[model samples]
Target: MNRKIVVPPILFIAFVGLIIFFIPMKEAFTFTEHRTENPKVYYLPLESERGFQIRYVHSIHLSDVFETYEVTANQKIQLLSMQYEDLAIGLPGSAEEGETFSFQDGLYTLTYEDNVIDSFVLLIGDVDADLAFRYLNKEINLKQQLERGKSYAFSVTKLSYYQMLRGGNLNDNRTKAA
Candidate 1:
């Protein structure tokens, strides 16, 4: 059964398994926690200043809040700024059509322009509200990586080196609960 030595080793193992399942390996910033029984996922790697931030602690104006997202070159999620100190309720009470509200020293920014955002759901604040996720120097304390009150879902995906070696990096603690 030597058909030219098994057709060049089965076409070089199917061209290296189609370049390791279609090459992509990066461009992530995902987090999904669906929970009906179990469903949690996490990811990071989306650097080169694609920017990201999520600081939280405003359970009801307990102060400190800071949105600031930007993964845009097409991946969506714009929302440029939102530093709060109290604008009441869920915040944002002014600046809409191409936003811009300021307050300096005491804090109360807002500054947004396009505001794309394709995914976002957050709800991991049972009470201690310290939820965080900043990037570019890494600072992920999403209530110690999700599952407080649970309700996560954020996005900016693109992962593929076979889904980052079948685990999808939560700093490689090896995730499962799909």
Candidate 2:
């Protein structure tokens, strides 16, 4: 009968719709812009235990500083190490408890133990710092994608497909600075 035929089609359509809605809800490393009427959200597919690095030039020292982090299975960010060239202002002169500091090849490295956080805010340099995000061989010049002088929050979370579509995935584009 018509009733049976219609019911099956309706159920099929509902199932497809649910799949569409949930597919892009997968968790990712999401970067959300702050202090704007309309905040932009950028996301990248991230697997637990994968590592990334943020490299930037110190405004005062003008030297390269690299900070490495890992995504924990519990969706936390763990500070793995920090490499910098300055012992000047704003730089840690000595390691705190549970951290090891050493100098090698013109750079100072501070490796941490259990330094984890739920999220962190990244402030783009308004004056002289150039910040970049590196994962594997792929690099995203965050200074180019985000507004200078603004802050963006980084965390691991889920985002809708619409939001992901509107945001930039620097991995797909090649606007890398030379």
Candidate 3:
């Protein structure tokens, strides 16, 4: 056997195997299926036309990677309709007092008195839904039970901060102008 030929083939096979092991597989290649559960509730401190709109808290959840459900004060599940329209724009369905829209990736916007406020984009994914909901629910429930007035303390997870910082650069200029 020619040693040179044998060595080269062995090296090539090892190199290919290493590449396959190190390279991340695309989501399309993933065999696992994912479904988003109900969103965890969170208290969103909103400042709107209404004076100190803290009473209008929200318990938000994502139905999937794209869809969201906002439980309003009346306990109605309002779907947050998402549309690209050139950007990831979310329009809440029939928002009233104390409603919120949350993405699976942790981006959230609170709607109070027909105005959007306290928008924060968080780093979340299909796997983080349970954590997101738990966090949101804890905060919202605490705020509701304690009746914490304006300027209450809340935790913006590291994931949420990173997501917001990254998405901040991609905000729609048209919306800002309008």
Candidate 4:
């Protein structure tokens, strides 16, 4: 009975659906991929009976380097200063804005403004620190041992604290291999 009006509405709905389907929605519904040729390392200052020591926990991928670090500590530990250093010995690219540093295999330094504050070294990478921490801290059941001199690619998965603590087995995990 109303063929003309019905046809127009159907065509409009189909056109809109086609537009939505063909549009690039990756950026809108996906997590930002933070790639890093060189990654940054993060550490926590741990006090033991022996003395004050730095425990390496997370590495911030260059993609998400933050100005401030969130640390969970039982006692109030003073942060004197923080700085970043390049550890890769033969890697190219210096620590410049928007530049990724290729770290040679070596120890780099992160100098804080105050010497009294404990400092840690972050190996520069394409991802930011927080994302790096999340990736590196994941508890994947190792199918095989990662050998020295070998590199592996991993996907970053976001996990809540409760999930991480339970599924990640983070309750008994240490920042570094003691």
RMSD of each: 10.9, 3.4, 19.2, 16.1
Q: Estimate each model's TM-score.
A: 0.41, 0.84, 0.23, 0.24
Best by lDDT: 2
What is the model-wide C-alpha lDDT for candidate 4? 0.29
Model 4 residue 34 lDDT? 25
CA-lDDT, candidates in order: 0.76, 0.80, 0.30, 0.29
Taking all chains together, the TM-score of candidate 2 against the true structure is: 0.84
lDDT of each residue in 104-136, candidate 3, tens digit only = 444434333333322323322223222222212
| Residue-pair clashes per candidate | 0, 0, 8, 27
Candidate 1 per-residue lDDT over residues 41-101, each given as its tens digit: 5777687788778888877768889888888877889888888878898898688788999
> Which pairs clash in the backbone of model 3?
39-61, 40-133, 41-136, 41-137, 42-136, 105-124, 106-122, 122-160
| Model 4 CA deviation exceeding 4 Å by range | 28-88, 91-178
Predicted candidate 2 versus true structure: per-residue lDDT over 12-110, tens digit per residue: 999988777657666778777877678777777775438999988887889988999998877889999999999877778789999999998988999
TM-score of candidate 4 against the unseen true structure: 0.24
Assess candidate 3 and give its TM-score to the true structure.
0.23
C-alpha-based local distance difference test score of model 3:
0.30
